[model samples]
Target: MDFGLPKERTSLKIPPALGEEVQEGRVALTPQGVRELVARGHRVYVERGAGERAGFPDAAYEEAGASLVSREEAFGRGEVVLKVARPTLHELALLRPGATLMGFLHLAVAETGLLEAMAEKGLSAIGYELMGEGPRRPILKAMSEIAGRMAPQIAGRLLEAPLGPGMLLSGLPGIPPADVVVLGAGTLGRAAARAFLGAGASVYLLDKELSALEEASREAPGAITALITQSRLERYVAFADVLVGAVAVPGERAPVLLSRELLARMRRGSVLLDFAIDQGGVAETSRPGIYQELGVTHFCLPNVPALVPRTASHALTATLLPFLLQVEDDPLKVPALRQGAYLLLGQKGGHLE
Candidate 1:
C-alpha cells in the first residue's frame, strides 16, 4: 500500500507551505510541523527527483536539511514508504520481503493478482481505507472527498462539448441553470451536491435512506430539493441531466446504481460521474482509463487526484507526514513489525504464518 509519496529520513523541517511542483525534493511544511519533529530527533530523506513533478526542487530539500539520494536508495533505506498509488509488483519485488506498508490499501476488491502476490509475500497490510477502528475511517474518507468534490468539474466540462449540452454551466441571461442529480447521500455524494449547488445549478439529491437524505436536507435547507425515495430508483435516473455516482460498499465491488441501458435514457449529452469507478464502476460503461484521461471527456475518472496533483498532494501529504514522523521516531514501529512478521508484512515467505 502506498499513497507512495516518500521522503528519505532527514532532521529538518520546512518553514512554510510548499506549492505544487515546487522543484523536486523541496517540500515546504509548516516550519513548526518540522521543528516539532526535530525536537524529537528525526531525519528525513529526499529522493533526487521525487518532488520535481510537484514543483519541489532538490535544493529545497537540502535547504530544509534533508539528505538526497536516488529513488532506489530512498526506498531501500526507508521502512514505511508513503506513496500515492498502491505499490506495484515491481515495487514489492524490491522490498526486503518483510516490510510494513501503508497507504490506501483498497483490499476489499484489490486486484486478485496483487492480493495473491501480497499474500505470497506475507504482507501485514493495513488499509488506510479500512484502518478506521469504529467510526472514523479517515484516509479513505479523504480519498472519497478528492473524487467526489472533483466530479462536478469533470461533469460540467464533459457536458459542454458540442456533441453534448454545448452550454456554459452557468447561464448568461435567459438560459436556465444546469440540472445536477446526485445519487447516494453519503459524504462524497453530499460534497458533489454542495459544490454543484454553490456553482449556481439546480441540485437534486436522491437517496433510499431517509436518514441520509434528511441530514442532507438540513445542510441545503431551502437551496436544494431533497427527494426521499420510497420506490425503485428508476424515476430519478430518467430526469437527470448530470448524474454523479458516489455510492460505496467497503471491501466489495461497487454495486451498479445505473445501467447503460438506463444511462442511454438521460439527455444525450448528459454526463455520469462515477466517483466509484476505482472499485469497479457503478455504471457498466465506466472503467479506469489511462492517465491522459485527465481530459476524459466521456465516462468516469478513476484516478481523480492525479489530475489535481497540486491540491491532492498537499491534502495527501498533510495526513501522511505526521504519521511518518511518528514512525521515524519509533523506527522499530515499522521495521519491527516488518522484522516480527505479524503486521503489514507483504506476503513474501511462509513467514506470514
Candidate 2:
C-alpha cells in the first residue's frame, strides 16, 4: 500500500527494542513475519540485531529479504515505522514530518509531553491496542492471551520466594491447592483462569459481565465464576492466596478495582499480580515490577509477554502482517483501525483524531 502518496509503496522500518538493558521485554515481530510482508511487495529495513534478543538472528532477517541497516539508517529511511513499544522522544524526533508510527501506544499511562511531541511532528500514530473493536482486535487478543497464560507461571514462582506464601501453588494428594482469584473476565483473565486450573489450583473468576463470567466458566469447567460485587470481591480478596488483576478498557486507563482498604484486608504474604499495569493498573497497590505494601507482595510487570519474547514476537508478527500488507492505502482511514483509539488520542491532546 502507498501509506501516504498514491501509487508509491511504503518504506517500513524496524528498530531493535530497548528492553534488553532494562530487563523489560518487547521485541514483537519475528523474521518470518517480516519475510511475509516483503513477499507482499513492501520494502522493509530492519536494524542490525533488531530481533536478536527475541531469538531471531541477523542472518534470518537477511535471508528474509530485509535490508540490515544501522540504527540511524533504519530510522531515517522509513516513511512508516513499526515497533513493539512506543519510541523514545529522541527516536520520534528522527522521523520526517507526517510519517506513520504504529505500535502499542499506552496512552493512559503515557506522559502528556510525548503526545505533544507527536502532535508537533504531525505524525500519524496507530496503536496496536486500538486496532479494532471487540473480537476484531486481533493484536490485543493474541498478546493478551500470551500474557494470561504467563500470569499463573509468574505467580507460582513468586509464591516460593522468601516474601511469598511458601507453599506449592498446585498441591499434592490430600493437600489443598492454592486458591487463585482472577479479576476481570476478558481475554487475559480467562487465559489466567485456565492456566491456574491446569496447575491444579482452585480458581475463582469474577467479572461484572455475566456473559463474560459464563464464558470463563465454560472455558474452564472447574473454575468458579461469580458476578462481581463489592461484598463478593471483599470476601474473595480476604480468602485468596493469589490475586490476579487482568481488567482492561480498550482505549482508557483500567479502573482501579482493588482499593487500599481492600488490599489491607488480604492475608499477609499473599501475592497480588496485576497484568493490567501497562494501562495504569487495576489494584491501588500495584506498581511496575515487584513491591510490597500491607504485607502483600505485588508483581506488576507491564510487559509480561516480554518475558518470552520469541514466542511473543511470533504471535504479534502473525497479527501485524495483514495490516502491514494494507499500508499501500491510507492506513489512518482503514476501517480496521479501532475508533476508540482516536477517542483516547484526542482526549490526550493529540492531533491525530
lDDT of each: 0.57, 0.75
Writing each residue's lDDT as its tens digit, candidate 2 over 1-353 gives 31111111112221122122333334545777777777877777887777777678879988988888877667666776776776678787777677677777876678668877877777767788878645578889999999889877778877875667787989999999999999999999999999999998999999999999888888988999999999999999998999999899876788998999999998898889898888999887777767678988888766777778778888887887776666564556555653424433224323133
Clashing residue pairs in candidate 2 (N, C-alpha, C atoms within 3 angstroms): 1-328, 2-328
lDDT of 1 by residue, 297-321 (tens): 3455455665555565566556544
Positional deviation of 238 in candidate 2, in angstroms? 0.5
Worst 10 residues of 1 by lDDT: 10-19
Q: What's the CA RMSD of model 2 in angstroms? A: 5.8
- lDDT minimum window of 10 residues, candidate 2: 2-11
- The local lDDT score (0 to 100) that residue 179 gets in candidate 1 is 75
Cα shift from native, residue 294, model 1 (Å): 21
> Model 1 scores what on Cα lDDT?
0.57
